[model samples]
Target: MSNDQAEPETRPCGLTPKGLERQKRILDAARDVFIEQGYDNASINDIMCRAGGSLSTLYRLFGNKLGLFEAMMTQTSNRVFSAFEAVECAIKRQETPEQALKRYGHLMLERVLSPEAVGLYRLVAMDCSSERERIQSLFYEQGPKRINDKLGAYLQSQVEQGNMRIRDTEMAAYQFMEMVKGNFQLRSLMGIEISEAERELAVEQAVELFLYGATCR
Candidate 1:
């Protein structure tokens, strides 16, 4: 293989001077192209033209359209997960499991209701048939799996503290998440309208149902 065809050697963590600027341009262009053209319709030439850069720059930076897509998926997922982690951190530092859980639920609802998340979810669902594994990887890495793991850690902590009765914290965490997200996700997937008032009401009710249980006191 020619030197140009060989894989790029790793550079420093920071991008080289020209690389940084071109990378930003490519990302911005890619986002517009993807949004405008959707998944299958967009082309590398179109993206290159939008970015005003040669095809080589696109290849060197992202490999191809799917690489660019994976980058976009990672970026969007990271933002949501960062929000999740912040809530988890706050919850972990709390005095009680109930408080931690409530805070986490609230943050989760806020994120799910956000436009960025809604758009991303819709996009993933739409592309699932054609890009099954890629979409699944994105969802698994940044969605329910991570959330359940964090919740399980919290539940285990509670168990260790003798604050709750639980045979399996992982199961408990998964159940809690299912209770919390089940309705909203279903509605969102169906394109049903979820007003702000309804979202707040649903979140509060779900949290209450999970912690207090449905059995009469």
Candidate 2:
């Protein structure tokens, strides 16, 4: 093959099932390494050691450590946001907005405050170097931005159905998310234990407060 030609293995759509599996393995290993070692201390070699893949393959697939990190963030965000898919379906089922928001709030609290997610958030927080700005931006775009957009779409649907009166669904989505998170997310990231009852109460209160402002009044 010519140097100018793209390699089939490196092309995203060209990857076979085995190649896709290997890619997943590498991403999983990267996630573990990043969480354990932080961004600056993590090495491509360490990830390759855990993933059991050749360096050339890893380089070909992700280009560099930053690329691998971006891909991992994207993958993780996809998994996190997938849980909210039920929100869309809830609309189809004609569930009340309260029911939908409560379900969404609970799921968001659980997923966003998970150990892995908290560790990743700390990993990003600890890095403040100029070179890591891209990593930070990628994290926001892949994680928070995507999350807000998903919930914003759900809120937009509610507004269309006249169940809510939000003029800006995006801002409403962000506010509702913050309400659900409350101080519990901060406590989780600080290694403080948050009881299940506390989480449930937070979600219930968030939904109530959100509806008071958002519902047709």
Candidate 1 minimal-lDDT segment of 10 residues: 2-11
Per-residue C-alpha lDDT of model 1 across residues 157-208, encoded as one tens digit per residue: 7778878888998898888776667678767767787777776666677777
lDDT string for model 2 (1-217, tens) is: 3221224356354788999999999999999999899888888888889999787787788866777888999898887667877877887898888898888888888889988788888889888655488988988897777778878998999889887899899999999999889888679877899999998999998888888755667
C-alpha-based local distance difference test score of model 2: 0.84
Tell me how many clashing residue pairs each candidate has.
Answer: 0, 0
Off by over 4 Å in 1: 1-14, 128-130, 189-191
- Alpha carbon lDDT at 6, candidate 1: 38
Per-prediction TM-score, please?
0.79, 0.89
Query: Which candidate tops lDDT?
Result: 2
Q: Which regions of candidate 2 deviate over 4 angstroms? A: 1-13, 213-217
Single out the weakest 10-residue window by summed lDDT for candidate 2. 2-11
Give per-residue lDDT, candidate 1, residue 172: 85
